[model samples]
Target: MSNNSNTALGILAGAAIGALAGILFAPDKGSNTRRKIAEQAAATQESLKENALDLKERVSETVAVQKENLGTRVENLVSDVSYKTEDVITTLEAKLKELKAKNKQLQKS
Candidate 1:
């Protein structure tokens, strides 16, 4: 898991333990204590759901950005290769022209 996930997990765990301890230690009727525990459990469940949704959103966003970056890099590499290929072709053509000229002069002499 990521650092952010670990930190959030740790925080959630700590809050849950703290809340349980506090509610258990309170001087109240058994029914009241049980009700408080149930309420706390429900609240914690909602919090976990929200956190999971938020993390999913962040992961999706990160993946999309990375994909876009990869696409751009690929395009740049292809463009560079195309230009270099053109340059190589041009150089070869010039050399061929030079060789043909020399061959013609020698043939005439």
Candidate 2:
């Protein structure tokens, strides 16, 4: 979960830094350089926004998948427990019947 977000953040930071360095080092008139810097900033901001949204979507998808898996596991466990309980009840009933028959035979004797 954190891993994906971390990678994206690192990439975005690196790109922003590299772009800034390139723009600063280029030879140009002051006004033109400032304009270029503003444009680059706006572009970087948009890219960051997009990456953030993508990260959110990926996290949501991962959570949904895990939730579904958890639900399935719980259902399976409940079904298994229900079957085992039935078997235990059947066994106990048979034992009770045997005890009753033995008691009757002893009373007659």
Candidate 3:
């Protein structure tokens, strides 16, 4: 299996074993043990929720940064192309003017 799947399975197996051990080794009465387990589960769930939210926020910030970087790159590329196009047009215009002047001189001769 993939590394990600293996890691997930390992984590799940560890959690299950830990929970079972906690229940089996508890010194308190059954009712108190059950209550403690419930409280611990609730706390763990809340912690996981907070972690997930933080991960999502980080991912969003990363994407925003990447998008802004891409936009800047695209703008720079477009500006470069525009500048090159203007240079080509100016050169062509100068060439045409020179050719026209040469043609007029040839016609006079």
Q: What TM-score do all the candidates reach, one by one?
A: 0.91, 0.89, 0.76
Q: Write the per-residue lDDT of candidate 1 for residues 1-109, one digit (tens) a residue.
A: 4998989989998999999999999999999999999999999999999999999999999999999999999999999999999999999999999999999999999
Question: Mind sharing the TM-score for model 3?
Answer: 0.76
Quick one: ranking by TM-score, best first?
A: 1, 2, 3
lDDT winner? 1
- Judge candidate 3 against the unseen true structure and give its global Cα lDDT, from 0 to 1: 0.80
Count of residue pairs whose backbone atoms collide, per candidate: 0, 0, 0
Q: Which stretches of candidate 2 lie over 4 Å from their true place?
A: none
lDDT of 3 by residue, 1-109 (tens): 2464457556755785698678769788999888878876776677566656666787789899999999999999999999999999999999999999999999999
Give the alpha carbon lDDT tens digit for every residue of 8-89 in model 2.
Answer: 7898889888988888999988898899889989998998899888888988998999999999999999999999999999
Tell me the whole-model lDDT of each prediction, alpha carbons only: 0.96, 0.91, 0.80
User: Looking at candidate 1, what is the lDDT of residue 74?
Assistant: 100
lDDT of 1: 0.96
Full ranking by lDDT: 1, 2, 3
| Candidate 1 Cα misplacement greater than 4 A, ranges | none
Write down the worst ten-residue block by lDDT for model 1.
1-10
Residue 34's C-alpha lDDT in candidate 2?
92
Model 3, residue 86: C-alpha shift (Å) = 1.3
